[model samples]
Target: MDIETCLDSRIIHIKSDIELIDVKGQFISLAAPIRLTGQLRLTDDLRQILACIDNEVEKLTLQIGVDEAGRGPLLGSVNVAAAILPSAWSGLIEMQTLVNTPLSILTDSKQLSEKKRDKLYPLVQQNALGYVVAEIPAAVIDQINILQATMLGMRLCTEALLVAVAEQIANDTSSTSYNLQAQVLFDGNRCPELDYLKLSSFGISESSIDCQAWVKGDARHTSIAAASILAKVSRDQTMYHLDSLHPQYSIAKHKGYPTRVHMEAIKMYGVLPEHRRSFAPVRRVLENK
Candidate 1:
């Protein structure tokens, strides 16, 4: 039996009883068939392993991932981020490896401690080929509503990322034309429809881009996870600053969420400009006053 494996550079062929398998400048000997629980499963197992490796290698390419933070916060701004990773990056980093570690810890920011998120924030930014973060303040959220605000933020971030990519291509001294065919992976079930008129300034057409929204994308997708970290960290910093200005609200502790302490502070001190007036809790407080 003959099995063929496809890789980025070449195709490897393995024949049954052949002593050697060469893949990507590496050679593996298949002369000794290993017995697993007294069952011989060398050929099938080896093939599966090689196929999985190929799949992973294929996924390590240029792509964009987007996610948002602070949508649920009653105060502070909503932050949306879009991250572009180079074609050489393997999308395998997770939140668990973000602390005092070299591996990129890419995962949903909520799953990571604040310290870990802070640690990974710079790493993500440094490794990213291009990245952009957009914030929609409380006043904007109140006017446009949270959902629209979030979508608008996403669009702006994406537009900025594309502009960055274009600039990088222009600056590259290499003669190779950078034809970046990126697929946008949004961390949700729905993405805001692109406004062609608004996107015209970025020179990006709707048809030229391929985008898809996935459920739990931040947890499942590496790029989305990185974007999650960027968005969360940026929003957290904003909340911390707001906390400094309004120490009574403890914005840093709850990060502007409608926590018990946050609600109590609203009742006692009234609302601040950072508080979203359209939010149920803030609106109720306004009604009572």
Candidate 2:
């Protein structure tokens, strides 16, 4: 069901002796629910529901979050990042405590200042079980278009991170076997197809994969916010490096956005190799040149 539908569903009050039924008709017995009052409190509720499902499979889940940056930029690569957060808990109380920490302060990368994102960059990496950042360059974006390239980048980031996590587990256990579950979340209205992903190859259960596209997920989910920070910081760092090499473009000022200064730079200094020729602003400039 969609978020609206899920929100419209009746809120259940958990009691030690009473049984609660979820939307899927699953009967769950809870001593108490993690009651955090807010519209976004549903995030905690969803985590509890997923925990219930994970209990049925008897597997520890890895929450994988994916987000992207620079998709709308007129130059440079679109960077995507995937972050993995472990969901190992003794009980619902422990799980609630783990998730309700300072991490909840994280929000969309665009909403944060550059200084804040830079500060959180290392913190996110340190907290995550594993993460991978992938980029689709402007040239490749020109070949396949921004949307397809973004999907491809996100897929690559998720695949690479999963493989890395699996490898780490195998090294720690001295065996290439595991029963990890994955709950993959994307920070947008639509996610790339996950059905074709080879769960077995990653030592995860095929049926245990719960891939969802959550709108405004960066604001609601800590994992998605962490991924957004990585992507945004990485892309911004790239732009800064590019600026150092070519100061005339003023890439560091606008970060390749189609702003008045950026457009004027393109018209005056002409298109660079990193400029997205497929974009209308750069295309118009190139056509005139």
Candidate 3:
């Protein structure tokens, strides 16, 4: 039998044989003798193994992940994504494997190429239990500063997703309770204030939801990674559309980042309505002009 190494190092696929390997690299034969002995039959699929692993660890409640893209750009809106993934690690792992995109390869949007992020975008949306992508435009960023704008975007997406999830549960015929327990993870050191959600009309309680700001959570958590991909791809598409309208700015090339080409374009053509006046580079151009 030929051994095949999956893109994810955890999963090893064997060709022409029915043996299964666990994450710990322990091999279990799924052939006749094992079955006759009444030993547990395991599938070659990593999801089954992951399920077993999940059970061994603590079972978590609903997980909500929030992340943003285009926060540092001198132009365009900041896009924030709130995503709810399956609480089980197995289910999260399944999302990537289904698209043939390994978890290790697609851990964070920053580390992924544009092609890979585009490929995973739709798959993430389809798999999410609930999701919301909110944009805070440059005008708003200028009004409240970039940090506040980013926080606002995060808050908006999180609120929208929470409401959507609450509505789904309320409408479910089989569910008896309106109470929901969830863990909200934000991909940064500081999360937006959600204390107001305690008095929300959706019957969601502050005590029931735990919000945390996890530094580099995008790489550590599957739900956050999915959110990052969605936000990145959405922002990229926005830049592409803007580029089509204003080819001189090369928005698509740098996605409105303060590159030499972008700065030169701003200097020659002047600032667009989309440019953030609060940003130093764009502000300097405006001052000089």
Candidate 3: Cα lDDT at 101? 35
The alpha-carbon RMSD values of the candidates against the true structure, listed in the order shown, are: 19.4, 15.8, 17.5
Off by over 4 Å in 3: 1-60, 90-105, 173-177, 195-199
Error of 1 at 265 (Å): 0.5
Across residues 1-289, which tens digit of lDDT does each residue of candidate 2 receive? 0011123632221111112212234444322221110011123423342332312443545677889999999999888888755444211222343455544445678888888898878777655555677666787678768997787667656655555444444433533334666778898988875423454656655576677898988766767877899899988999999999989889999999999988888888889999889899899988887
- lDDT tens readout by residue for model 3, 89-110: 3234335532443333556899
Root mean square deviation (Cα) for candidate 3: 17.5
Those runs of model 1 whose alpha carbons end farther than 4 Å from true positions after fitting are 1-61, 90-101, 170-180, 197-203
- Alpha-carbon lDDT of model 1: 0.65
Would you give me the overall lDDT of model 2?
0.65
Q: What value does the lDDT take at residue 168 in candidate 3?
A: 41
- Model 1 over residues 58-118: C-alpha lDDT tens digits? 2112377899998998997888888765434535454343444353555678889999999
Error of 2 at 49 (Å): 18
lDDT of each: 0.65, 0.65, 0.66
